[model samples]
Target: MLALPNYPGDGGGLIVDRAADAPRYEYASLNDCPQVHPDSPNEESTCQHALRDCPPEELGPLLRIWRRTVAGDVVLEPWDSKGLTCASDVAPGARPTLTMADLKAQFMRTPWAKPQVSSQPKGNITLVNLTTFYRVDWSTGGFAPGEVDQSVLRGIPVRIRPKLVGFTYVFGDGTTYGPTVSTGGVYPKGDITHVYRERGEFPTRVLTTFGADFSLDGTRWDPIPSTVTVPGPVTTITVREAQAVLVNH
Candidate 1:
């Protein structure tokens, strides 16, 4: 039996840093992806194959990803042009993941590769209709930010459980100051006034989760940042919320 689980010492060929631009750095396994080292008999490919083109039985357990090629790119196959299926592609045994990459790299096959990935929140607006105006004081309750994105979304599903997260309003003076504001969270009831000392593009964003989300094990934190290019002296202003990130490499 061609071992159902991963080939003993590897977690699918070092995983190839799925986030990396280049393919896996090495290949030397019996079930290696084919496209990688097809000609070199002993040269085994990475998981690119088992994940993309192999059968469910061949793919022991890591079948969750479904061998998606790429998010926004076209796959090609020059082997088709050669009429020999390209000597360097599809050998006896190869890494399914790397094979998938080669197929895409050839730029001769499918234009849009397949990807069975997870889902995230969509964008929409709604109004917050209060049950009792007297009981729900305007001071204690302000509209929480109502939005989400890949940079701050979780691996789990919100439909299964709610997430504890919210948003904060950024003023133009590079600080958050208090101003009587009204918002309906995910929905919008009417217009609310948030005072920014300057007039500019203050980035506005929100969180779909209320900080008590069941999707994540740890804190679902999102450093919603923005660059508000405020104009001189004007009570009513605009702002651009951007997460200023500094990478030290």
Candidate 2:
């Protein structure tokens, strides 16, 4: 008699008796043996051949049955190459791919420096005949053009390089200035200057826009499709009209 242990969820073991006049083989579940089709004329022969040559290594969730001979010594049957399959045969999903859009999203989330607005006349300024020279204090939170941010997404290494493209100055009082590439300098030579029409307290700020490039291998770099604009903290400037009175010396 040959005994095949049933797979999990298959109720009973299969028993084949060779001693009978016509050898009889009882199957527990037809679903467990996929090779045995009901429409096939030689289904029984195919099932028998499949069982005899089932590879043990390919035994997984569905094909975990073990064949053994129930005789004087109860010997284990050697497995061969046949119709069994394991989970490894199933196709896997596509690998993760990086794009320019993905890198731009990451660059926007990076902790970039917030610009600090500086004026030549400090806090208070005279409105008449005075031009407030505006500049960005790059001493502390300055732009690092060559700085690179690195990360790994689904085993793909990505490096992003941030570059300061332009600056926009908001001189409050309904006035706004350019997306110019100038960082603006101090006093006489400074290009970014604002003259207030009337005397009052005004709130001012600077907007910094950054463009970026990304790389997968560090050697080859590609530009990102978009740029990020960061706004700086507000700086209040008090503009007062200067009045002169003649006094005895």
Give the candidate number with the greatest TM-score.
2
What TM value does model 2 have? 0.58
Angstrom error at residue 211, model 2: 0.8
RMSD of candidate 1 to true structure, Å: 21.7
**lDDT tens readout by residue for model 1, 113-136:** 111111011121111222111001
Q: What is the C-alpha lDDT of each candidate?
A: 0.25, 0.58
Q: Which candidate leads the pack in lDDT?
A: 2
Q: Estimate each model's TM-score.
A: 0.18, 0.58
Worst lDDT 10-window in candidate 2? 87-96
Instruction: Evaluate model 1: give its lDDT.
Output: 0.25
Q: Positional deviation of 174 in candidate 2, in angstroms?
A: 0.6
In model 2, which regions exceed 4 Å deviation? 1-93, 124-126, 139-143
Tens-digit per-residue lDDT, 1-249, candidate 2: 222333322334544533433322222212124553333442332212222233445322232222322233433333222233332223111112333335556887777777767787865454655898888864345445568888864355777788888889998889989998777877889999989988888888888888877766688666665688888888887888889999999
